[model samples]
Target chain A: MWRKLLTRNEFYVALVVVGLCLVIGAVNPVFFTVGNLFDLVRNSVVMGIFSLGVLIVIISGGIDISFAAVAAFAMFVTAKILVPFHFQGTILVPFALSALIGTLLGLINAVLISQFRLPTMIVTLGTMSAFRGFMLAFIGAMEITNLPPAMIAFSRSFLVTIKQGRFTYGLHVSILILIVLAVLVWFILNKTMLGRGIYALGGDRSAAERAGFNIRRIQLFIYCFVGFLAGIGGIVHSALVRTARPFDLVGTEMSVIAAVVLGGARITGGKGSVVGTMLGVVLVVIMNTSLILLGVSSFWQRAVLGLLIIIGTGIPAYQATRRRRAA
Target chain B: MKQIAWRAILPKDTNVRWLLVITVLVFVSMSLLRPTMFFTLDNFSSMAFQFPEFGLLAMAIMLTLLSGGIDLSIVGVANLSGILAALVLTRLLPAEASALQVVLYSLLALATSLVTGLTCGLINGLLIAVVGITPILATLGTMELFTGIAIVITKGAAVFGFPELITFMGNGSLWIFPVPFLIFVVAAAVFAIILNKTAFGAKLQLLGTNPVAARFSGLNNTKLLLQTYMLSGFLAALSGIVVLARTNSAKADYGSSYTLQAVLIAVLGGVNPAGGFGRVGGLVLAILTLQFLSSGFSMLRFSNFFKEFIWGAVLLVVMVINYLTNTRRERREALLQAKECEVNAQAD
Candidate 1:
């Protein structure tokens, strides 16, 4: 089991992530602080959830660049409706509603892709624009700067707290929920027939179909799950900022995709794992946070992420080609 | 029969006829909807002035698309190229501008634009062709890299105030047409001739249609792809130069929305996403159609948000329809082939 784990790309990624964290801590002792470490995990929750969606779709041999849009759409819809009422309640209402709304939108994408047999990338690209535009046009295109106190309070509250030697570090409620969600997703991907079917579908569509894998259902599930997760991402984003802006997290899809891809997720499909994607998400979050700690502008994040994606994809691709040539 | 007849004059799959119909319908509807602002020469002339920025970009994207790959980096290349030219214009030029100096500086700026574009394109070509990186991912990476370079140079600020000569290239008109529009026309014509009249274009068509077949046929697929991407990069640079001239400012984020818009225009022009089908004439018409719709919306005081929605809807709807019809046609052909094979076996 250890040998197999070592052979896997996720294991390596996890090591790199940890190594980088240690190095960052070494460089700046503040980076290793419990408070800082927890903040990093909290910051990653949204993208981590979003990457889970990306990982599934990629595993199923399809790509959706519109999750950010989906998240925004669901979040905006939920936020716009809830921000008006100062209801004293759990923020689950917005979260659940957002997930449902996101799933429906994802279903539309799924239907279009599966029914028409259209390419997922192009279709999602179109939806990405359309959904964002829809949100931009919502309510005279204004950003919802004022979120309800319940939502705001929910966003700020940490679910778990750890105190050790004069330092108190708290994991955000969203992060705890996300970790649980990640476990559920991990169970689905690794321990379910659907998971095996996804691998089959990505490996060879016709063979997978012949083997009795329901391609349509799998595709539907993937898109919907992605959308649902994106919805969660939207809420997390809004909660983090304590506001539900219409156009928040615009163009963040690339970064999320980058993280997933960096985590050994092949764009060609049929290969990737939840653990790998989680590691990728953590790495991205740490890198971004550490860049700030390093006194570099956050703007470098996009460029650096771009480089990582190219190197990530390029190295794997080059190795594959070399293997083919050798064979 | 009509398809064949039209195919003689246009590419077999050119959606120009339907596009023409749609364009006319939009024009007429906009005219009816907003009579005061829709049809004025002034409005159109202004649209023409800004038309080439995205239009040239669309054309650049079309080249890569035609070669069976998409260049998501066109906007990035354009911005980078523009940034280089802007640097030259601002830093290299003397404070006092003599006529000779103006001409020299303009030439130098144009050279910088082309060279910068070529260099970026060269890297893209290397990544996709030599390294075998998928076009989308390669261009995506290059897009970020190029844009990053521009941001680093400019520090995320706009570089402004070009010479008057460059502005004339951007907005000046010959007779009644805007200069940028005229440049677009010339560019479209050149692309049309190159695509239709050149051996390289034929090779590109074959490459896009089937890479393995082309490789078997002893075609240099890598070189063809490299050249195509490089041309796209060059075209992007040209666009960047025009934008820099017209806007009198250059920034890394200029035309950030263009990557999607250019893809929209190219696809809308009936450039198949799978490649091997497109025409410059059709592309020009597509650009005009979109520009009109965009301007029409603005003229009617409609928000630009609708334009984005429309672009997306149009892309999705058009693609779905194309896929359905193409699949049906393929099935029919397959059926006919099966029957012919069976007949031949029986006769033998």
Candidate 2:
């Protein structure tokens, strides 16, 4: 049992995450504080949500760089459409509306990929530009500071608050959304027939088709689901940040993809886990935000993260090779 | 008879033929729309100056795609190379330096950028070819790594203070053609020759077509991959020099949008993203076509965002058309083979 566990990629990744945490905690005990933990949880919300959507795509033998643009379009357009109505209602309304927009956009990708048989990366690249351009050109490029009341109120709402001296750090309600979505994604990926279809397709598309899986339907579902999640992530991001910007989330594809890959998700597809992905998200978020506690400058943070991703991926790969040689 | 003549006039490659059609359509429409502004030599000259950096980037990406790999790091490598070259120029050249010293230092700066690009490519090659990481992931990591190094070097600031000689290369004209355009033409010719005539290009394509087959054939897959990535780096570095010369400055974040745009141009040029097929002629035609469209759009007073939207629409439309044509061709070939087999069976 121990040997079996030792060979698993997730074990090593989890170990690395914990090792990184202990190192940071040792360097600065303040990293162990409740407020810091709360802040970390809050920071992970948007990125974690993005990672979930990306993880699904990666597991299905494809990559989607357009999620960032899709999220931006959904979030920005939702904000723009809401601006004139002044319809101040529950946060659910905007969330639902954004999700609807995202699903429609994602459907475009699904149709192009499934029906036309275009390459996923190329299609997403085109769509990424199209969506971003549409948002900036037709929708609007201005940052909307005047968000609906529910969004502003939701930003202030917290599931948990910790008072630390003069400052109080509250775990935002967005974290709850992330947790619920993560669990839902885990269930979808593990407990559903559609999930099995996704795995089979990723493992080998021809074999999956031979096995009677509807490749087109599964692809449609996967992309649309991703779009839906991206919409949720977008709305959550705007609510948490208290503003919507057309350019927001455009450059986050690389880090999110890296985090997903680092989480034991194979870029070649057919392997990944939600728990592992969450751990990867924590590792990436720490590498991004908490390096200051270790006295590393902000400019150097990206370098460190890059090195960590390379090392993180390299170790597991080396082990797999060695194991294969032994076998 | 008409179809045969049509085929005779057009290139044998479907992608080249399609690109030619698009080029003619864009040129004629733009010329007709803005007869004075679009048809002028000056407009064409200015576009020639503007497109080389972007064209070089597209070629850099096209090379990687031909090897069945993608280099997301080209933009990062370009920026890093430019920043390094910019640093060499600013730090080494003494104030009020002689014109001779200026020319010499500029050459040194160009060399530095090339070297930086080579080293960056070597790192990417090692990670991908040796470490067994996916090309996308390896390049993505190196993209950040190279860009991070640039950021650390510049502290997220643009590097300036290039001497006049280099700036002149960016902005100057030789005869009727811009200097950058000349450089682009020369580079394109060399790439065309190397890809069409050389053993390396043949092996690289074979490697891309099937890595396992290449390995079984006793080809050094690792060496070919390394060379391919290194060449990509070399091209990216050359593009960096062009950018530095043209803009007279270098920054860590310059041309962040070029990464995606380069992929678009490369794919539109008939470079298969899955690997093992592309042409220099197609890529040049793609670049020219896009440039004309961009210049025309600007002349029409359309917003920059609309250009992006149009590019996306064009890419999707081209992809759909290509897909239909490919399927039709495949079906026809299959049918012909079936008919031949039936005839043989009747004879038997």
- The number of the candidate with the highest DockQ is 2
* Candidate 1 clashes between residue pairs 3 or more apart in a chain or in different chains: none
Q: Which ten residues in a row have the lowest lDDT in candidate 1 chain A?
A: A134-143
Question: Could you tell me how far off, in angstroms, the CA of residue A278 lies in candidate 1 after the best superposition?
Answer: 1.3
Query: Which residue runs of candidate 1 sit more than 4 Å off their true CA positions?
Result: A1-6, A162-169, A297-299, B1-14, B327-348
The per-model DockQ list reads 0.58, 0.72
- DockQ of predicted model 2: 0.72
- Sort candidate 1 into its docking category: medium
The estimated TM-scores of all candidates read 0.93, 0.97
**Residue range A133-230, candidate 1, lDDT tens digits:** 77776443667877767788886687788898887778887877788888988899899999999889888999999999989888888888888888
Tens digits of per-residue lDDT for model 1, B181-207: 888888888988889899999988888
